[model samples]
Target: MTAVLNAVPETSFAEYEALKAVLDTASRRMAITVVGEVNTQGRAFAVHVATLGTADPLAPAIGFFAGIHGLERIGTQLLLDYMRILLCRLEWDELLVEQLRSIRLVFMPIVNPGGMWSMRRSNPNGIDLMRNAPLSAEGQVPFLAGGQRIGPWLPWYRGRVGAPMELEAALLLRVVEEELIARPVSFALDCHSGYGFRDSIWFPYAKSTRHIAHLPEMYALKAMLDGAYPHHRYVFEPQSVQYLAHGDLWDYAYDRVRAPSVFLPLTLEMGSWLWIRKNPMQLLKREGMFNPIKAHRTERVLRRHTDLLDFLARAAYGAPRWLPQGTSRQHMMSRAIELWYRRRRA
Candidate 1:
């Protein structure tokens, strides 16, 4: 007689359950790949990738990532909600189908299921995936927040020195290389929560404040967003404007990418401090600071960000139309320097 296997504990997690449901509903339209796995508490949790649209090498692409820090459940929820919205629209929206034909959309919503399962910021190994990259800060970083080699016991640990990157980090590298990096122009939005008082959208160069080669491109994108959503509250700035950190995965990825092609990686640090101020008691709970405890608050957060996710897809779809060129590009670069860097000096 064949014995039936019991459900894995991770399968019971709400995020994983939502993931499975999305896959099951959209499997015919999406190319789902099990990129890797993380083991914790004797449970093996799968890292899933869901891709929509064409994989044309020349087509622009956008990747949406979340849950790198397990305790930041809002990140995962926002992405999952966005995916559900897209999938719901796909059944009847000809505009969406036509758009999908022109560009690629990639999702890796739950990057660190093991960490999420344990409700920890770092993975089961106690290493922060954001800080697990091989690159180091070009200059001094803020104490432990910059990343440390003080072993897994401490937060912001970078894993053992000279060791291979964590599995989640490797999988992210491979996904970007295959989807976004290969395209002529692409963007990545990695969602995170529990940062500061204001919702912020940050670009690369987390290792230093020096300008990126694609500053002009970044400025153009910011301009488009500003024009499109004038009342939007996100504070768009370079990650270094806040504080430099060691081993930022996006910075490492941007440095490794060769010239000529444009790749913009953004981190969406949702402002959980606002939630804490609204519900002051949340600060007392372990995971509360990183997530909204009330159902209505969570729904509001999801409603606010899904439009931005949709906007990125359309932006990637129409990149050639708005991406600056020649003299316009030069002017934007100069303006970017004057706006961001010069203002910092003053």
Candidate 2:
């Protein structure tokens, strides 16, 4: 374990090797599955899904996902750090062991290994996985950043029209549907970087400005976060607030699960611009734009989000206690609209 943590992985395969090491250590406690494989160049990269705790469909589940964009490797690294911590604690953390019995934890730390290996934002075929979903935006979107169908040569390229989803995107959806959407209550946090000046926690509706049906639930979750961590800094809102994009995977997945079942999918967009601001020299390199170049900064980034991740896990475990109800739900809905929607309208 020490060797795995200390070693600096130079390639996506090395990152996978490190993950396998941690999985081997906790093999007895987890149900590990290789959902699919992405063949790029001459090598095949296997996509893995690992679950811990009760398998009951009614139990609350929380999933942590990263590495959808190959350029944003920090998200994958952050999750790997968290997974290692949880796996190590399983040996002696009695409280965590007890918590796991009542809740489920799912992980898919490296969703696009081929893209990671190539150091590109898109997959080997050049299609942007996040933009490969069939969904389309209802309102006007930014010229290209909002996603385009011109060709894979451009960034944020949606695949050819009427085509099936990319392998990585399809596999990710399969894991979410099987492990998360099936549960009565579930939460998913997908990590990412290379965005704004401050780290932001964004919810669904990347395709439109309309609010999600679970606005009250989203408000309740944000309220819990505020009450628990008063000093924390996170812009909690819908992804549409920043920019509308076509084919957002979360929007597509969130729409599939109906009422009586709740699935709150979030994207943690870590602000890499701050790192660039601190060290302007990073602009000279492509990877540096999305990742911290300095070791100390990287360590800080790894430690920063652990609390939020742990809080989400605890929140999922105690969903019934905080999820809004009846009158309280109505109040939350009003507050959510006022806070998010009304402001945008103005």
Which tens-of-lDDT digit does each residue in 176-197 have in candidate 1?
9988887788899999996689
> Measured by TM-score, how close is model 1 to the native structure?
0.96
Candidate 2 deviant stretches above 4 angstroms: 1-12
- Candidate 1 local lDDT, residue 54: 85
Q: Estimate the lDDT of model 1.
A: 0.89
Alpha-carbon RMSD of each model: 3.7, 1.8
Q: On residues 1-346, what C-alpha lDDT tens digit does candidate 2 reach at each position?
A: 2365467455445567777876787688888899988888877888888899888889999999999999898898888889888988989999999899899999998899899878899999999999888999989999999999899899999989999999999999999998999888999999999667999999999999999999999999999999999988899999898889999999999999988899999999999998999989998998989998888898998888999999999999899898989999999999999999998899
- Can you tell me which runs of candidate 1 are displaced by over 4 Å? 1-11
How well does model 2 score by local distance difference test?
Answer: 0.90
